[model samples]
Target: MNGLRKGSLVTVGTGIQLINHITHEAVQSIRNAQKVVHVVNDYPTQRYIQSLNPDTESLNHLYGPGKPRSETYRQMVDVIMGHVRSGLNVCAVFYGHPGVFVNPSHAAIEMARNEGYEARMLPGISAEDCLFADLGLDPGSNGCQSFEATDFLVHHGGFDPTCSLILWQVGIIGVGDYIADGRPSGHIGILVEVLREHYGSDHEVVVYEASPFPYPIAGPMVQRTTVGRLSEATMTTMTTLYVPPLATKADRDMLGRLGLGAPQRS
Candidate 1:
């Protein structure tokens, strides 16, 4: 501890689609780091990281069948911090935006900073970013609400039906463990039940997954179905459910208070 050089940490994301989606800054961080530890969704990304720096290693081995995801995240933090404590300039890579739905990346950064090591995170393209682009939806058009599927159900907070709703990890709701096959949890039915309370049985929803490859190679998966048939739809670990806003009218009272006339209908 006394003789080791000062350690530092930087976490970055590869984005949903590799190579193209990843920022140059993130790529340079991976290239310059003394050690790189990553958990990417696809094999192509893994190879790309290794190509950037031969010292790159995967954190995927930490995940095991039936292992609690929380435990795996803890172990990942430990490993990343271990490298930092050894006086290595460590780069931690994740699939999506490092700060989005990634527990270990945040934990490692916090630990590194607390232990007097320089640590920071860089932003990357996220699944939601791709979703917005692929679906031609603008959050500013109405409003947007996002939630983890289990949290949406467990917390039971009322959401706006007049605005868009996005539920992430819908395929794995209520699943706390790592499954080898990326199986859908049985709890999705519960999510359907709850969503129906807000959107109704006949409300049309989209089940979407961003393609790991670029458009020419593979397009994003977009499945349209009614809320009533959601339980019967195929869902995977990466699926995100999009519930569009219902028909909504502007509040004339509020518009009048602002001294503005009613918004012209398009």
Candidate 2:
């Protein structure tokens, strides 16, 4: 079974945009793999992945209307394992960072390693990276908090409105099942109410979608609105909500303890 060790797995991300964000290393992994499974952005990206490896297969067909996404993810992981168990070097690529929100990527890697296969994940640019670039927001400037919209509403233990808040899957706010067309989140009002409790109704927020194709798709889409008006904001399954912090005084005692002065760096 020594040769079976050659049947390894590597998962990578295609990033947010098409063609541009794929890393050189990930490109090599795709080309070298005996079999590649991809769940990417659009047709063009699919073709690009296909061009890299003729053995590429798409898992998009696994998705079904009104189906639970957890099952879909499980099936995806199973498919990846099938390739690996067959002693084929497998590459499972997903959109955005493979490690970010891609459940199947993580599940497949864990399962592969558990089965004594060499499995590793490579990082790729995510929507969060594009959000930082497009919105000119820095997590370091003011500590940032990120959460899935439903998780934030249903089970958030604590969150700081005094820090930037990013709510992912804003367009699928309360959705429990998968929709083929990515139906607009029907319960955005619940999210707005939760945010309104922390930051007042008039506090500004943004609905952001990073462009996938870079044109007519509205490159790096951004819609600015207030917490109260968030319900009126446009969003898709890809949308993320950004809530900036309200003005607050720095902790003078902490600064003094650290022998530092008031804010100076920009």
- TM-score winner: 2
Model 1: how far is 166 from its true place, Å? 0.6
Backbone clash pairs for candidate 1 read none
Q: For candidate 1, lDDT tens digit of each residue in 1-266?
A: 65434989999999998578999999999999999999986888899999999998899999999899999999999999999999899999998899998999989988887788989999999999999999998998878999988988888467788889999999999899998897899987888788788889999999999988776759999999999999988899999999999989988998899898976442
Model 2 global lDDT (CA atoms, 0 to 1): 0.88
lDDT of 2 at 169: 91
Best by lDDT: 1
Give candidate 2's TM-score.
Answer: 0.95
Worst 10 residues of 1 by lDDT: 257-266
State TM-scores per candidate. 0.94, 0.95
